[model samples]
Target: MAATYKAPLRDIRFVLHDVLDVSRISRLPGYEDATPDIFDAVLEEAAKMCENELFPLNRPGDEEGCTFENGVVRTPRGFKEAYATFIEGGWTALATHPEYGGQGLPKTLNFVVEEMICSANLAFGMYPGLSAGAYNAIAAHASDELKARYLPKLSDGTWSGTMCLTEPHCGTDLGLIRTKAVPADDGSFRITGTKIFISAGEHDLTENIIHLVLAKLPDAPEGTRGISLFLVPKFIPDANGAPAERNGVACGAIEHKMGIKASATCVLNFDDAVGWMVGKPHRGLQAMFTMMNVARLAVGMQGLGIGEAAYQGAVAYALDRTSGRALTGTKYPDRSADPIVVHPDVRRNLMTMRALNEGARALSYWIGTEIDVSHHHPDPAVRQEADDLVQLMTPIIKAFLTDLGFDNANRGVQIYGGHGYIREHGMEQYVRDARITQLYEGTNGIQAMDLVGRKLSAGMGRLLRRFFHPADAYIAAKKSDPALKELIGPFAKAFQRLQQATAGLAQKAMANPDEAGAAASPYLRMFALVALAFMWAKMAEVATVKIAAGEDVDFHQRKLKTARFFMEQVLPEHLAAFAVAMAGAKTVMAMADDEF
Candidate 1:
């Protein structure tokens, strides 16, 4: 059976307009024209492209994968055509600067569209997704000349880009990289190195590929400090800024991956490639972070996207497949057996997937709004606070969302039983594709460590107040309301546990750092749960008021029910997480080095 996709535009609009009130983004200088009508049209058209063009290619893309012949990558059938359609629709420049042939829309809108793309086609989305990150990096850190050279093409989708960071010897440890860069007579550098696991590294979709590579220059310091960022294109441009001659970069080969097979993960070898520095020499890591931070959020969306796709498939299957009758009675008296949707177990799985997907979506969009405020807010204090919140939540979003996305994919497979195991159903492909989101863009473990080790203590825990104060304020405001008591009670309890755990981990980590390391993963999970609970509470508050006004009663009621299910069924896991975090690191460290 072919995989199906609907953009969930209703929920998307609800989260954007009803929950987050994204119109406020228009107050920022560049977003004044981001009216509701424009947002609706953009989303409606994006939905058409994603559902009509991309979703159908997902199964075939995974089945056929990418083909590499003599250093050339051919994306699965329909990929190039779909990509052309995507670019032609002006989707690529949706959130970019107007000066660079872009629409100058808010980044929040870009993220909303991105989620639809990822849901429709995870692998194919990488081509433009990588380009967006690369554009961000150059726009932020590169010189005016470099920006003028690269930004226009990247924004317009005439060309694509890649971030070259990892080598064969070093994955996360950038200090261990052995790539070398040497200065030439005309001020450009000659870059030579082999970068592995480069997504969108080499492809036939574009005329040129701009690679943001990390290499070490002569006389540079040791370790990560020695690394420098270089803008090395596949074909060095002529004076007119068009591909003039072939540079020394070439695709060595592509990886044989477990999933996202349609995305070409290449091993790129730069043999003294002509390149120019992107930022101050030896400050490449900081410069690259301009890309990494956005990339992490994009990866989080990938998780949410795959989970949503899986949930939809599972729900469709559950509604159609028949098995034993319902526990109480026959749901379909006219049929031989009731559909699986009538069963409690099936409902449980579907609801879990649905709740997580929706809650995560709300939380992500809220974060996206924060990102816009961080970048564009008029008040310095407001921007700083929003930045702090983004810093604190990025890891939680990346790790917890991806982890649950994988779990949701599995639940989707479980709901399908044996048919899910077969390739034709496409549930298993979701599982495979979601698996990578947790591993790459800083593994979930690294994200947890960053959360517990750096972000929690940053600014002497002041950054945490970005999340805590709002949550506290919401609980205080809603605690006394009769209709909101159930939601507030659970959320308040989880919030309290989160506070205690935060303080406890701070003390324990101070005494022994391993306690932080040991507790990191569970603590991040707990943090994410509390964050989702907060979003649910906020969403329920809006839904309740709307219900009272007799506006879209069914939608508002379902919102309340989903919030109730999340609070009742899922939020209690914070208790276990809190307990595990408080356990310290002794048991984990006590095991012998080779005991396994």
Candidate 2:
């Protein structure tokens, strides 16, 4: 059967309007019109597009993949048409500026729409996804002339974009990159190098492809500081800002990836491509981060989206497929066996998937609201605080969520037994596709390192406080409430463990940086669990108040139940993480080189 998806619209609304109360976004400068109704309408329409249009294409797109010949990529059947409809519907411009022909919606709304698209079709999502990141980079850092030439087309989805950072020689180490940018007499640069693993690098879906490439200038210093960003398009634009003559950039080959087969991951070669600078020279990494940070969050959504799809598949199978009888009694007396969902083990798998998915969705959307405040808020102090939260949470969202997403997809496959291993069942594909999210957009390992090394200690724990204070305040306020003690107790304990671990890691790092490196992965995981516990607590608090008022009693009850399950079952993992992190690097480094 084809992969199925029903956008979790109800939960999305609960998280946004009820839990996060995103209506506060309207108080920001440009989002005054973003009432609940507008958000509902946008989400409903985006859901229709994803469910009706993109979901059906997912299996076929995976099977067909993309075909490349003569340096041209033909997307899977229906992809171009779907993309045309997507752009024509103005979905691409939802969060862009009005001056650039965009609808100028808040990023929070865009986050929901993007999640729906990714859930429906991860491969197809990449085409527009990369463009949005490119649009952000240029809109934020590029000069007026560059933005004028690129932003409108990118914003409107008339053209697509790619960020070319990895080369054959360098993946994460920008200091090792050898791509060269030479100044020409015409005040433009000539870029020449090869970029590998460029997603949406060359495709037939759009008229042009804009590449934001990183290269080194002749007079530049050594390593990363010498690097600069350049805008090199596939087809050079005419005076009217339309594609006219071909640029020197061309696709050399496309990677045969393990998953997301429908998305073209290309190897691009630039032979003295005509390009213009973006931002100040030697500041390319700073500008590119405008895209990378957004892309990291977007990749996190990929994990959540795939997990949602997998959970749906698993739930549907569990309800329909009959297996051994229930331990207590027969759930289906009319049949010989009860559905597999009746089994404790199967229920465990399903609940684990559901708990992780819902918690991640809530955490991500909460962060999305912060993104809006960081960008559009009128107060500088509030904006700075929000930005700090974004910085602190980005790695957690990217690393922790994707790692669990892969696990959830695996659980979906396990829930289906032998049938899931086959292609037609579609559960296996989710596993394959989600695996890449952890690997790309900076490996989860790198994200963990970033969290422990850069974010945790930044500003003498000021960034950490963005998350720590609210969680601390919530626990302190609720600890005395007898009804909420079950939920709050575990969360409070975990939060305390996280604080102690943070301090412990900081002190250990002062003595030996290797201690931080050894502890970073577990430390990040522990931190992520606490952050999610905080989200679950907030959700439980909302559910508790709503239950008291007798509004949506069943929904609120379920929320409380799930929150309890997470606290009792999942949050305890923090103890193991904390213990491992506090172990330091002693045993890990005891073995000599080549001893293994």
Candidate 3:
């Protein structure tokens, strides 16, 4: 079974150049030197890595998974080699700070490359992906001495990293975590607790594992405010930055379950391990969030990646597989039956997947660009605006992208029909692989709540104002553009509905504390549908102009048509969601507690 994935470079370039406008990105401080030649070279290398090293291992890794024995975790065969290849390519640190041995590429470029890696092998990508987050957190908050010691190895993939926040008893509720970090004489702490659902927690891909564990200190405040971050390693690095003696961190077990089988999801026991503080004492949760926000967006990329992969596979199958004749005519008369691609419903599925995937890519890259601008922009106001945009869009990226990713993956299975259900065809693998994306990374539901409850009204609707105002103006301006007018009109209507929902949630919150929580998830979905439609409309605008230029005709036409499909079929879901939001808290709270 050869792993199947088309790099979608044309589509990627379309998003980067025509849709999101990456040329403006080059003007940012560190990004000024990111030449087109360099961009092409980097993407070319990334395509080769995904098409060769990573994609080949995806299936085998899924089948073999990881093995745990005697406190050791062994990754699937060929994963170690594939991961080594990944490190050698310098992908692990592609977007890290240049001062710390990183390539310092624009984060949006990294977003494109990341989708390729994940589409090729999401499980393997997690190893380095999580490490990048750890690297970012350390770069952001750790002291200069600590950064000097760890950043180089992590950036180069001499060491890998893990976020050890979730425990068996507590996942979303950090307040309930029981992990303890006792301060030691040398200013280091002894961390002792069990952490579960830790991806890349224990793996053979790297020599040492840098565990960013969250724990409570003695005399620390109770709940989340008291939680602090510690840099606990599997084997402590010596002064020379080499793995020295073994640390007390050991794998209790590895989880066995659905999807991303190749990823090492470990239950780690840190028994009185020597740990160094990464950020301020009693601010561990806060510090870990820096890592979490990065991870959340990265996980959202997983959705985009898987969706793209599934769409690619489904399109191939649809073009090749023969089935019932087209209702209109016999498109393929020479064959036993017309190809599935001739069928309207099949086209609907593929277009839905394609439209959603492209919309997500554009939006994700846009958000990634904002992340770069947030960090590297010269003006503080520019940085702040970009940062605020990233914050507002984070939950949408996590929730909506994953939701559509899962749906698209399942739709791919449907496109394959009976064969898709079997393991050999590989469609089921995609379906399974995509499932966990919705569950982890704060869960799409939690992401929704964060969007409506925290992000929308957090600053008394100020953040929502920043996002919607520009969108409103764009919709108002694009009304006369015939190609985008229809798409933008519905999206604009949805946007107004979102504004109404936003105000409704605020009013409900004023009346009842629980009202916000009940309306949060649906409101998030309503907003995301509109946001993605906005992206599709933007793409349609770009596509319409590019098609007029007479370059890449088929690609631009597909973009225009898919954007049309999204407006026709997908954007309408928000109307129902808005209706649901209008229904309010009583439906959710009315359920009896003992009903379960």
Candidate 4:
């Protein structure tokens, strides 16, 4: 039987109410109406829709995928109907501002919704997910005129969106792009380019598809500096904001991908497409980053979502599938064979996934709350601090979560044994789907570089201060607290290794950048491990109090035990990562280019 998903509502509530006090979000400006009751109701409905409307489609959607012929793309069966229900329920506008038809909630809640969708149907989530990114970029940077025309529909989910960045010849190097944009007399531009790997680029889901395109203007300066952003729609809207004439942009072909088959990955041909400048000319990358950053964080949530789904599936398999008895004796004599859950090895895998998921969830969702605080806080210093943490953690969240997400999904297959290898159980599908998260949103390696090369050094190490100061302070304050005595020592040790790694990488990169590049991956992992350790220790503190108070004893006790496992078994892995990172770039860059 295929594994089914039941949303981790209890754990989610624990994070919201117990570990992190999200009611503070309501206290922020513009989110005064946001309350726990409302958030719970929203999440409850989202869970139902995901479980009922989306989960059933995951297996069949992977089977059917998407079909394209004659420039037309059709999604798997029931997708359009499901999307319609999504918007009708106001799921798309949950976190947007109220000004442009949004519900004016908070980004934190939207993040929870994002996870549910990804777990329920990742491929299906791509459509609305892209729209949300485009919405944020446009909302933050686009002109008021553009916002009036596009924001309402996007907020209402009447129109879908895509980011047209990567080209057939270029994926990471925007400087190598050949897309051209010519100024038109009517304050618009004629864009000609072919963008590849454009997710949700063309589909039968919405009335119009908005493409936030990146291209170079004629007579532009060299490299990415000369690039500009343009708003190009599949069908240009008329005066009444209705789909009028079809634009020149069309899907040339769709990639037959390894997974997320239900989502359209297209080769978008913008042949003199009518588009308008999004931000200042020659500043497209800056504006587009508004969307890219959101997408990157969303990708991290994609990892967490997939991990949670796979974890649940593995747990079900471990408890239900019977094999050999325990080494000592048979625990369940009623069964013909003992359940695999009796094995220590199986317990290890289960514990590993559980620890990673719970830790990542606590950390990621806290970051989500900080995102809201960053944007809504009244004090500039407070806002800057929140933003710094968000910026610093963004890469870690993207690379680390996706990395673990794939690992946990694969472990699902491992636990299921032979049944997991084939399509009957649907465990393999999670693996295939999760494989892309590591590659997309600026690949995990790219994320590492950005962390070390860009964010780590930003503002003379101000961003690092955001995370390190808080973590260091926590370690010092909790070292004597008996509640976290068992967890804090391991976390403090890991944190110190992270500090050593950071100083070493920063020093080496100053002499030869390649040294930093070589170790960025491990450094990022070490940083993530320590950060998650910090989260686990904090969760332990909260759980201890709750358990002492005898509130939700089972839940709080479970959290306390998971926190221990993370510190003892998972967090100590950072030592190896620190060693790998401090090894420098010698062996990594040793081989000659033509050694073969």
lDDT for each candidate structure: 0.93, 0.93, 0.87, 0.93
Question: How much does candidate 1 score in TM-score?
Answer: 0.99
Model 2 ranges with Cα > 4 A deviation: none
| Pairs of residues at least 3 apart in sequence or in different chains that clash in candidate 3 | 227-284, 228-284, 229-284
TM-score, each model? 0.99, 0.99, 0.98, 0.99
The digit string of per-residue lDDT tens for model 4 on 1-596 reads 57879999999999998878999999999989888988899999999999999999999999999999999999999999999999999988888778889998889999998999999999999999999999999999899999999999999999989999999899998988999999999999999989999999999999899999999999889998999999999999999989999999989999999999999999999999999999999999999999988899999999999999999999998999999999889999999999999999899999999999999999999999999999999999999999999999999999999999999999999999999999989999999999999998799999999999999999999999999998999999989998778899999888888888899888999999999999999999999999999999889999999888989899889998898888888888898888899998899889999984
Instruction: State the local distance difference test value for candidate 1.
Output: 0.93
Model 1's C-alpha root-mean-square deviation from the true structure amounts to 0.8
lDDT of 2 at 239: 99
Worst 10 residues of 4 by lDDT: 91-100
Give per-residue lDDT, candidate 3, residue 530: 85
Writing each residue's lDDT as its tens digit, candidate 2 over 1-596 gives 44579999989999999999988998899999888899999999999999999999999999999999998999999999999999999999999999999998999999989889988999999999999999999998989998999999999898999999999978999888999999999989999999999999999899999999999999999999999999999999999999999999999999999899999999999999999999999999999999999999999999999999999999999988998899999989998889999999999899888888899999999999999999988899999999999999999999988998799999999999999999999999999999999998899999999998999889999999999898888888889988888888899999999999998899999899999999999999999889889989989989999999999999889998889889988889899999999998999999999998
Query: Which runs in model 1 stand beyond 4 Å of their true positions?
Result: none
In model 4, the clashing pairs are none
Off by over 4 Å in 3: 1-3
